[model samples]
Target: MSAPDPLHDLGVRADADGGLLRLWSEHATAVELVVFAADDLDWAIDRVAAERDEHGVWRARSARLVPGAHYGVRVDGPAGPAHAFNPVHTLLDPYATGLARADDGSWRGVALAPLDAPADRVYEAAARPPAPRIPLDRTVVYEAHVRGFSRRNPAVPAELRGTYAGLAHDASIEHLTRLGVTTVELLPVHAFVSEERLVRQGRPNYWGYNTLAFFAPHAPYATTDAQAAGPAAVRDEFAAMVDGLHRAGLEVVLDVVYNHTAEEGRHGPTFSFRGIDNAGYYRHGVDGEYFDTTGCGNTLDFGGEPARRLVLDSMRYWAGEVGVDGFRLDLAATLGRDEDGGFDAEHPLLRAMLDDPVIGATKLIAEPWDVGPGGWQTGNFPAGFTEWNDRYRDRMRDFWLSDLRRERETGSAGSGIGRFATRLAGSANTFAQERGPLASLNFITAHDGFTLADLTAYDVKHNEGNGEDNRDGTDANRSYNHGVEGRTDDPEILAARRRSIRNLLGTLLLSAGVPMLTAGDEVGRSQAGNNNAYCHDSELTWLDWSWGEDARRLLATARHLIRLRAENPALRPVRYGVFGETTPSATQMDWYNADGATMTIDDWNSPAERTLQYLAASTPETEGPNRILLVVHAHEAPTEVVLPAHDGVDRYVLLWDSAAESPDADDAPGAPASETRPAESRPGERVGVAAQSMRLYRAEGAR
Candidate 1:
């Protein structure tokens, strides 16, 4: 009745007797399966002609398609501008679960036995731990890389460092669990290759944004044992990493690049999709020139059935078979673009992905923008998706860094606290009401930008090592140097920078939306002012675990702040409160000025009024009823402020303060961060808040 779905069973399906390989190609005249000898990859052992079925899907069967068989396809078609068929250039299967490079630098697909088995059997409940299934509100995402996370760590064994297995090591688990983050968001683990330009310059794509295959785990991330054992073993190692994190009550979210492949521009190499059906798989112009939108070459034509199905199928395999908890779609705006290359919130592919049964349960984070025309769809994604809120990032940075720099030069902060207050309360203007605050994945620093320490130490990007004549990387750093660029020995400047770092960290964790911390920010990791270090695989990008007392203090402060957020449900509201109606899981907010009076228009908009107190009380649903008070002073001058007097609130107990150098000495992992004894005060009592500092308190209820 329905012309049997053409993309179904589109990859190798094997058994003991033989195997069947099916591939979809609209323009190809013939398809031949080429099986190579296991010992010698260049030696072809069997060649079978494939039969083209009615739906344009070509099918071929052979006993050689069994597990561990090295194979490829040679497609032949008439020469045309819209066609690129080379029967001699054996192309990889678009749905390959494993890949291997040949002697001549060409690519071939490898058949793995586990791929044909039932998904449940491959990842049994006992062998593979269950997903943490952490709710959006409780999620604290620590964005780290597989290699950079453990490469320089002394705790990890020498041989296992920089491998997937290393991330599952006891040391790694202890570090993550102690940090209080619920999720570990990793950089792309999908199989990728360096860009053609980076390759020529003898540099590596350390960030792994350039993907070659969506289904295959990047084999290089596996330890020597896994790699030597073969592709299936490599995947099992990845699974073990996930299992370890899950056992520690941590979830894993992968950064996926389905927007573009490693195949660069029109003149680039003929890899899997480009060689299979160039015009059908990628967006192209009239004369076959690629419609490059992802900036790293051609964009996948998500409008087409086969191309869309490719991404969906890959996601299903990873989520169901591999047991990954979630995915963060890199440059995801391209996925929402239609046939005409226009971004649509209601794109068929986007809707389908949100509704898919397997992946729907998993967290789907969208980078939410691309380098294409009309590609900045930050707040316009579908309801089910959570987006990287760039507005929130820029606003927070401007308030804490750029605006501070402006104040020092112009004697006045350029903007008021209105915007900053909005972001701190959950960016209701950016995301929809139905989606609530959880729709925004808030982060000031990501893998693509400068490290947290660099933001306080560097005034501009230092990317001279990238071989792009320093022309690469973004120029809008929104960073401050505190009277010195790079590192400084000035005690005053150093103290100021440390306080600023704490302020940024405090704002990020205490903010209403879900927070994502870059890997080594807790220990004050710096990149030597290099804002974009994507091309560097050296120690420059690897996180150095060796740090002195300052870093240790910073880590303690981060842990304390994270614990406070976990205990105070008012700080992590799931919904926005209505005017008078109390919404469950929402926070009822009250704003006050320096005089402890209700905030008026002038107090909210005037740059001169830099101090304000925020009182948030949770309309409890899952957690207990909670209330907290947060005082913020933006100017670099000590000020005395009266605490707000609210109904049911009698006194305030201090939780954390950015004014302090760091957390107390005993505020370590097992330490109780009790009120610094003398810090508690009654409502309406004036308290001294240090310059450019913030204070958090638990509002002790009288009722």
Candidate 2:
């Protein structure tokens, strides 16, 4: 009907003999494919002229373009305000499946032959099985770095430590399986390079956000053998890791960075996108200045079809070929911005990702914001995508940490439990009713901020090591140090911090939304007050396997809380409850004050009234009918709460308590499921809630 899109198959594709190469550049007057010697990348063996089609795609084919051959493209184009095309500059193919560094310090793309049988196929043939496809409601995500996760693990082999294989190691799988997280959201594994500035400063971009190539896995993260074996081997290792995790019933979710590129500012680098089509690949002002929304130098121009297709292709490769279960998009708001740079809910790229058959079926979670204007789009993503709820993080922290600090310093907490309760029951005011609670990926602490332990132990961020002279990280951490900052020998302070950790973990795992736990938070890992530890690949950022007494206790408590959440269907509602009607999979919640009486509007807003009781009953759809009562006290001062009397409930069994030093006995880390059964109490029974703690009770009713 119409001219076929030249962007289709825009990379090297193997045929029966040689290979076909396609390159896209609207401004390029001439394009040439340069093949390098296999042994010496710096030496060019041949240059083949490429013929341009009507769709601006330049095509060429050569027997030398077979697998393992190194190549790059040279484009001749008109230079102007928005364009940075250079005829002499050697550029990488945007869709390069593999990349390599030459001895001369330049980069080239390695041609990969189409797999006769995909590695995932071979993996399947081995009967490794596939992902469990854990339901969204039942998914508990554990966010970790592939390298940092196993770097310090004692059980992982020395050579395998800090590699993709390390994560697939039996010990690592066992640890994750034992921890009870259904999904593992790994930080970026895309091919990335340290920022020019970070490299010059003798530091590296530890988080791998500076993506160089979207389709390729970071080769350095693979084992030495894989790295020596080449890109295809690296990819095989990555696939094997996914297969291993899948066999363990763990879903692997990649944290992808499509918003920006490693080719930073105009003067930064002449890599793939920049040298190929700078203006078309990056968002820029009228004067050719970059419109940097990602705060990472250059933002990818999602407004262009080529750029959008690049992301879609990358996603399809990972989801289909690699067998990952999901993706957590970094700086996702940038992907939704239109040509005019305004945030649009129905941007073509966003819609395409949600509608694409392969990617749409997988879980898509958005970080939902960038550093640009109108950046805070927490609940603004479309129906199919779940967004990281920063509002929930702030409110929970404020009520538990900052509010408690205010009470100690100003004689009154700054806010009531109203906002906290909204998040607890699911932020109906934020997310659309159709999207429901699952749309909210609720977490109090993420990789970018303080750990759960730091949230209770640090009043200020200590980010001097980031080379920004303590000016880097966000000042508004919303954290309190519990009378002393950093490490403290004070028993009272230590006990208070432990209680705060329990409360935070309890709230997150018990909340009515998808929960994401930062990897080492369960073990009380701290960045030593450094909220922004993105530059540190050392022990500071790695998850330490060695656990102290407090860390062990906290880990056990976390496991117990996660288990409790799985057992109680009322805690995880699929939909928001209507005020006067029963909705399937929705939780009908009733609010009460310390006196067990219904809460008044005044009580909800009063700063002095910091204690409240919540009773939730689940309208069963797939699970049995369930009811639970949660008591929340937000002040340092102890309070007595009267358990609310519900129509169908007769007695309440104590399920979990945050005030307990350990979840079980002092000697035992986690209490057995049977031992967690405390004495049952009748309605109106008074229970002493310790300072700044939460308690959960399962309501048993007379049938």
Put down candidate 1 lDDT per residue, 124-161, tens digits, no spaces.
54556678899899899999999999998899998789
Clashing pairs in 1: none
- Runs in model 1 with CA error above 4 Å? 1-3, 115-126, 666-678
| Error in Å for residue 693 of model 1 | 0.6
lDDT of each: 0.88, 0.89
Residue 569 shift from truth in candidate 1, angstroms: 0.9
Count of residue pairs whose backbone atoms collide, per candidate: 0, 0
lDDT of 2 by residue, 528-559 (tens): 99999999999999999998888887888888
How does candidate 2 score on lDDT? Answer: 0.89
Show model 2 residue runs off by greater than 4 Å: 1-4, 114-128, 666-673
